[model samples]
Target: MSRRRQRVGALAAGSVVVCALGAPVAFAAPATTSEITGNGAWVAQAYENTATGIYLTPQQSDVEGPARAPFGSGSHRMVIGESTVQTELYRTPKYDGTPLADITRLEYSTFARRTNGAGALRQPTFLRLNVDKDGDGDQDEQLFFFPANNTDQQAVANGVWQHWVVTGSGLLNVGGDAGAGSATTLAAYKTANPAAELINNDDPADGTATTADGGSIALITGGGNGGGTDSQANGEYFVDRVVVGLDGVDTLFDLGPAAAVQTVATSGATVTPSNLQGWYHEAYDAVDYLDSNQAFVDGPGATPAGGGALRFALSTTTNPDRVELFRTTQFDGTLVRDLRTLKFSTFQRATGANTTPQQPVYLRLSVDTNGDGGMDDTLFYAPANNGTVAQSTWQSWDAASGVWGVNGDQGNGSVTLAEYVVAHPDAVIVKNAYQDRPGGGVAFLVGASGASQMNGEYFLDDVTIGSVDAATGRTSSAKRFDLDSVAPAVSVGDARVLEGNSGTVLNFPVALSRAVPRAVAVDFATVAGTATAGQDFTAASGILTIPAGANSGSITVKVASDKVREPHEALSVKLTARDYGTLGKAVGAGSILNDDTKVALELGKAAKHRVEASVKTKAPVAKATVKLFRVVKGKNVRVLKDELSKKGRLSTVLDEQFEKGTKVKLFAKVRTPHGVYVSETVRHTVR
Candidate 1:
């Protein structure tokens, strides 16, 4: 005889209920839909004796009694047969109230082997989760799986392995319960059933456990005995730890940082918020809070019945070039509001020294009052160049016919009222407003453009519609530039001969109008009657020192020797100032010189018996001519050759050679366009 024992009761939470066979009483609920929020809460209540009926189909039709038990405490045996079983529990919405719509998911995996020395042959067995709706006995919905095999089990001798999978709806399926292998397999009973969620759970030899968190039950088998008997008759399978909820909600269901929620109390008044709400999800769609770039409607407290006001203070390193406010209904797609506009302020220098002065800044307001995203009204203030404010109103876009106007009059200041009507077709009444201090304010809209003024040092207080307005007072408009104002001045001092009497030393004082000085340059004359512009003079402790003995006083300072210099030409030196707030035009006086003409060269030669002469010049030297004469018996004899080239240099081979102990004289005459300058006669001896 076979003995059976059963226990029936609710395990814990209101999630699962179980009943013993042939018992009138049944367990109600152990886990509820709301209590299964955390992990491990539903594990104890998952398994129960819930099967309704079981049918077995053997592989061989002529097989007799049940197969012998190869590894078990009892005499029950197993047979090689296909089986189909149905559970009594009616699958609903799991633990959550959200309906489990479709099971578009399934899977299977495990380790197994044959018992009769021959490899086990897998026959398909379907596992299905049936739902009985409308109190009908027939299942209205079912998640089924077709037969699956474990052909990879031949590698290990009943080794352990694990495998699992997840569906599109986040369902997890795991299979690894039978310890090793038996006749346990999974199959889908329905062929045309809608797609359902399923996954495999097979344990590996590495000792890692696989879980089936949100899927249906798993199928596993016990390992066969060495005596060719199936040992899967009395083994128990475990199905624990299940969860169901919205995707990504398990981590982010709490309210974000506490936000200040305020209400508006005026009509026809613009309302702005202090803090902006970022992107968020509400139900199936994402949403975002209001932006500062859009026109707003007052809630309930302005002149009209439905108006309110809001204000925000902002600061940035760069000036507030522009600011815009916008409102929208959807967060993912285009904005719902048809009107989009921007208002901005321009800045200018106000006060301070020319090198480091303060600048004054002003604001300009423009708007596209109509639905189109184009500017219809423009107002500008010139703080630096222009002394007055400018206003313009123009009509261009047509919302009705979708045609734009070409000749619309754009008026300035008071005359702009007539143009405002055509410009902002959607605006009932357009008005420009200005506030100077705490309570003093004026309306400057349309014809009142010049009436609204904010002068002197005043804060831009709140622009509210009612008594409950939040306005902050402006303190000062003073700003300064980070620069030096005074221009740099350089002077060339007197020259002192440091090395030889022929060498010259130059000195000068470089004074800066401002305490902060940048750089300076100096130049010197060369001995070859030319300016050597390759030399550089660097500033050290606000002073540039040049050695007087270098290159024999042929060194001159190269001014402005930056990378972009002309080939051999030197840069001209000048005293100039830069980076001053309002003093960029200021400069100091400095001295420069053209001292190349002051240098002289001397040459010497050995005394000789016969004489010859030659002369050369770099620049064109006008002259009467070159003459070579010899002294014979105290009487001078003139040579036959006498010629002058365009250049100053002259060479002459003597026609007659002088006798030993004879003296020779060579003279050169240089003539300018004005007059002729004679050179001292030079005499050379010929060997």
Candidate 2:
């Protein structure tokens, strides 16, 4: 007997309404240009005929009369003997509604976990999407099936869940090797001589898909080798979220604060990983747990609309001793490099052992920016500079003032988050600092984190990074402090001069600590050493003006020269800070090179069939090596060496005989305390 496919209605449109802290969670609404479609997560249907009890939970199993709970927090369908279930969307479903005519593309993203008995298992799940080409109720001719594999035995039956997406153009694609693709089309299945199942790349679960007159699609997840045995045992499944787009937003999972803890405690239960679902934590100096009762979180909105939230030890404390995601590398920092803002929600409470009246519940943003495999660059949204989070209230960090903080070393010497966003727009390897002074050279979740290896606790949720435009609600005028109005730290620039050349302009570079809002200037003065002022070089003093938002500027020093050959001399320049900011280190050094033409060339024939180099200096040549060179094809080739006559003169002969009128180029070289100096090249035709 042919089993008639049963039709199940689409579930509710929105998810459980939850509070952000003080207000409602405004899920990242689709920007004005686009639309959004989300079927409340964990609300799909399940059906089966097996004797094994069916359940409505996403956990391995729930104690809350889970079997009869209808729809669990992370819900899924229970499958038995070729039984089927439905996946719905708000207005975007082409299953039962008019096919979107503007369907330039179709995309699907969802999270599913398998639930099956120990019985021998074959692939037992599949998703069938349909489109009604005409107004006719049936979409049978327009259905496509994507089979899901349940090959991992360890995760079988209420096992680990995985995120999946389908890119539908002409073919259904998973985009990566993990998702299997099928060559078998809907048309191919109907034409097989014996009507073979069109399993495609997905292992054949022998499951079939069909559409009803209303264009509603259903999945007939397969049955056993032959119905009558446990080998064809029933299969159960769970779906946490399903999103479809005409153009819509993707779902994101924030770790805590409003994150409902699935573990219900036995009275007085201590913090432990065994009691956690969808979370990874560490505890000490504070007790962290999923308290089913509202009082435990004490702070407002302690309960998720769904009835549980992960709680930490405080509303405020210098010690963050707390909870974090499973591991550090879990997030790729570069994902937000281009974004100007990172937004998230959190709940705070001045309860338990942390009764400090402070309202801030904060966390730092750490990214593996250096890629040495650790989050070295840390940005802190300091509560003192950043506003304190209200107790029991939900707040949004729009990358606006209160949200952008300083570097992890606690702001002593690091760029602000806002500053980094402007500077490192291509950074990757970012994560929230999971441990204190997290050490270098460790995997995202592995070894060497400092003292923070086990300290700090807080609740947070809804983390998202966006660009300035995406966060239109945020504005530059909103910075917490008037950074532009105040003066910032500055470093003086240095200059160098050439005593022999005089008239050389030496440049000094002045660096500012942070960008400021207004144009500002710094005063500089040169203090002479062995070099005199005005005589060797004019003394200089003036303001180096820097424009608004500019971090550095330059100044120039003029150098004068006279007839003198001396050692290099250096002068120190001091930069005094302007009224607006405090001064940091302020001294720079300049050098004067004393390069003079000390050697005189009197080229003459040694009268012994060789060329000669007679070198003379203004003073007696002292401890200097005199050398001779002959030009060959435009290049100077060393020809001979000679000792200077103590009276500051030398003449040398060529080692090689030259042809008549070879037209060789000659020059005299001398070594000075300053450096080796060479005289002007003199050409002498072979005499």
Candidate 3:
């Protein structure tokens, strides 16, 4: 149908005219309540054969379902770049030929914004109804419902959603011989032109139903050649949850994208910047980490809570103008007054010889204070302006609590959050107009033109924001974003111990590459190689826990000692790490050394009555001493005692006054740095 109208003013000369000639896509067949199911559509039609430049698309950005529209997953957006031409989205309804008195409720939700240059033009899309005034077969009269005509100027603020009801409101009529100069309410208009009946046309595809043949309702925006200069102005508008009540039943039309969960929600969600998903950054230089604007980095100067942090940089030579890092597709049109808290940890360092402690970037919010598409002002939370900033150390900012500087009115150096709210009550985060990038709703920026020392590197982590319910005023849990790159890798070190007479402990060191905020646990079990579980060492199996904020811990295994001389035994402790971490050196090898000693004693054949003895052990003997005794009358008597050689060998002959069948006993005692060792006693008889 013809969905456009001309204003009640002189037509401007040199006007650009556009015409839509293709076959229009048919809307869903009319029912009790007609709804725009999938990506809702809009087509251009001319008033007096002329149309404006209109752009319509479903918003693809992350928008909270039901919270924004109270019905749909997304919203349909329409932009009017040029004025003086009218465009609209229309639907054919089943309530055609019904009386105007039968209509009960006619309302829809709208979000409208203007550009930077458009001044004092705050009107959004208007609703139109085709009516048959004289009960004739043709529908000749057009009824227009303007939201600006009913609501106050404050309710028309930019970036805020508003619901308007037009069923019982006044409407302007521009019909045959009824000049557009006069405006009257629906009651007065129906009284003036009695017997007004709705018109119905079943065929929408044949292009036969014109504006005069009324079976259609349309949501229209954009100005025409008439009505004052302000009537034809540029604007961006969104409409959703269109409700039409006929007779007694109400039909709700859910508009916009299909119902599905996106990657991130508008609010009450967390994001760890391991990748660039749902984030926007501009590349400026050849340096990979710094140029990409957002990078994942680790080590000492990175994340204070361990793992990795999100990195961004500003340069004096490459990007000397301005640089900003922001969420790619999140937080658009979020009200500033609804925010409860905003915080994040930052590690700052400069690239030049400047050693003064400073932060490279500050928090910046591009706000639409006047409901325009351009940035009306910027709210800056700078560390230098609020408090002290440290270099090469992680520092957190209470962004929501700080006094922000307002850059809109030539710099209000200290504007409290409460004061800003009172002045710009409907201010919201928006995608600011920029030549080089699609600036995000919320972001961190370095205005290098103003701040000369902004040439530095910065690391951001643990970014969190809390929101409060506008109706209830209750705060919600903070949505935390931990910009982590990788998990910590755990490893175990080998250990060695000497087996003693009593129990000894073998300590295996377990360590992580970096410290984290949460405690890390790994299960470990001792595996036997040559050492038996109970005989050689105590079998140990349990979860080894590394405390939060600590990098190292030890696992102890008890070693059982004995006097038996044997080879060294080996065992291993294997580690299995849990989630949020990985294994590095999975197994730790352990060795248990033997500590027992051995000695030998024999008689020498070169000399008569000569005795030789030697001592040997895993440990070197410091000194050795041998003793010789003789048994007489069933009593032992000491005969000789002498020190042995360095090799622990002793050889000595008995005194001359020895007789046959004489009983003698010899034994050797050896001393080492560890302890003393004694050999078994030997019995010999002189022949």
Candidate 4:
């Protein structure tokens, strides 16, 4: 099958690239759509060649099985970078009109084979992306460091597929193996640098000097220093499905194929009644009550209409034996303090011909206002007014009316139910203790006073506690609304970065879906990305107030300054949700690009007999390899080399031949995770 096509200029969004077999494709979108024919690939640039080891193929082998093509259908891409994948020239425009800086995530499939023979360590292949993420000329270098001896390395290297989604600032080796492989599924990995920032970048090769033009994607074997020494780049590896998100991506495009959403779904603060809180019952001369689930009771078509219901039954006990269900622990002075009305649904029936109904049925709610050993306030519902009833049936209560029967049906001590609710608004404890016989703690079946053992059956459903509304002075809705437990949405502006030594203020906005009657305060903290707290920027934590009826509020986070010359860095400000509304995950990114003039070690004649070399880097470096070479016919021939001292300083005595001033020169190379940085060769005669 012959597949040849002519292409000119930079690759466009819809430019189709024909593959030798299977399909033809473009780089605009995911290959899931049928419009993209054949396989996974884009028309590579004419200048790109496999001989230099930067081989990028859309698909390696289109096998018809799940074992291959883990991306989607057809073939997945294969990217082999033997230290020659240019990072500056790959910056092409996209369909969404998105630039690389707006990207959030990049994901791709990669695998490495275990080395043979003893001490067979898995060869570490550095996978990274987001080259020049800040749109600055310099590339923010992040290394996905794979441990040489991971426990799951064999399985991953043994044909088991793995995927990585890169994000985070300077995602340069945040640590650990990307992930282990699974037989039935493709292993997942986070290829994004979480702490990626323009700050604390230790490598100068990642600076402007190395950019092809201004931007490009970089994937290479081993960590190439751009001056040879890419030893780790020689290993055999399988990499396909190249993806990159400028910041964070979801639909997968300019963002890498498998990157997760840029922002996480937000949630509001919530207070829900945990199950097993208590639907309790006790036996006093009474064996078992409803005995339905041996816990509470269940019935059909009850009250507020949810599903089923709970029925309360009593055995033939002494007239007024009393049992109760307490709202203990649940009423621990938080969202609910002084509840106005304790609503409930109940059904009373008369058995056979005993039309007397069961007198004195008393249901009461008490509040421990002062936490003083006993309940200081009480509200009781007495159905004794209606006296007795005839037939047995189901009916709704405490729903629309917010009361058991009628108003004025409750009283405790001269204070009526309405007055008690207003008095103890801050009660610490509330209980449902229907005084059975009137002692310190009365007997069970207090409602069935002087009646037969089984006075028919009384059923209760949808028992709720309605608190007094702060604005309306009464319970707003009978159902007490589920408190709208949905999590709140959160967003932080993208432009909150520190420019140089200006010490800009990083502000995070906190907003709510609907205006709350009461003010909601959220806490904010400094989260480290590539930038570290105390070192790169100042660490801060405080409250952000969203006043009543206000949609948004701001938290002003203070950024710091330093004299260290480094690459552009990133920092994140996090917001914490408290009592009122849900706390959302709104992170404000802080970028700190170097504003000071960066200086590298200069090697040249310092004295009449000795050559002195000195340097100042992004951070402290150790054991730097310094080379002193003699210029022989324009070729650099090594004469002698030594490592720099702790202060990043080097001094050496030149060869006897150089003592005569042949215009000899020397250069220094600093090894870093991104790659080795070669200094500009200094030409000077040494004695």
Per-residue alpha-carbon lDDT of model 1 for 1-687, expressed as tens digits?
A: 112232212111111111111122221111111221122221111221223212222111111111211101011112231122211111122322222333322322222234334444322222334333333333344343222323232232232222222233212122322322332222222222223232212212123445232323322232223122333322222111122233211110111112222333322211223222221111000111112322222211111111122111122221121122221111111111111211112221212222222222222233334434433333222222222322211111112111111111111111121122222223221122112111111111111111121111111112211111112111111111111112223333232211112222233233322221122223322221122433422221222322221111112232322222123222222322222111221222222232211111111233343333565532344343444444455665666345456655565455555566444555544433323334455555445
lDDT (Cα) of model 1: 0.25
Per-residue accuracy of model 3 over 1-687 as CA lDDT, tens digit each: 122232111111111111111122222112322222332333333232143232334212323433355333456565555544444444445567778777665777777777546566546767777878887777677777777656532356566777776665544555421433465677676677778866653323324453332235766666454333554356666776666666644555556656443223333222345445466664322112133456666633435444567777666676654344555436667677667678878777877865544454567677777677556666666666556777788888888877665552112245556446544446777776344455576776543323333567777777776665444232344466666667678999999998877868899999999887557789999999899999999999999889767899999999998766679999999999764467999999999988766555554322454433333433444345555555466666666676756665556665543455655565555554445565566776656
Q: State the lDDT of candidate 2 residue by residue for 32-113, as single tens digits.
A: 2232222322223332223442322221221221222211123334344333222221111242352333222233222233
TM-score of each: 0.19, 0.27, 0.42, 0.25
Report the Cα lDDT for candidate 4: 0.39
Q: What C-alpha root-mean-square deviation, in Å, does candidate 3 show against the real structure?
A: 18.7
Clashes of 2: 33
List the candidates ranked by lDDT, beginning with the highest: 3, 2, 4, 1
Per-residue lDDT of model 4, residues 590-666, tens digit only: 67655443336565565555665555444545566655555577897876667757765555555444355556566
Give RMSD to native, each candidate: 27.9, 25.5, 18.7, 42.0
- Candidates 3 and 4 compared by lDDT, better number: 3
Predict model 3's lDDT versus the native.
Answer: 0.59
- Displacement of residue 366 (Cα, Å) in model 3 is 5.3
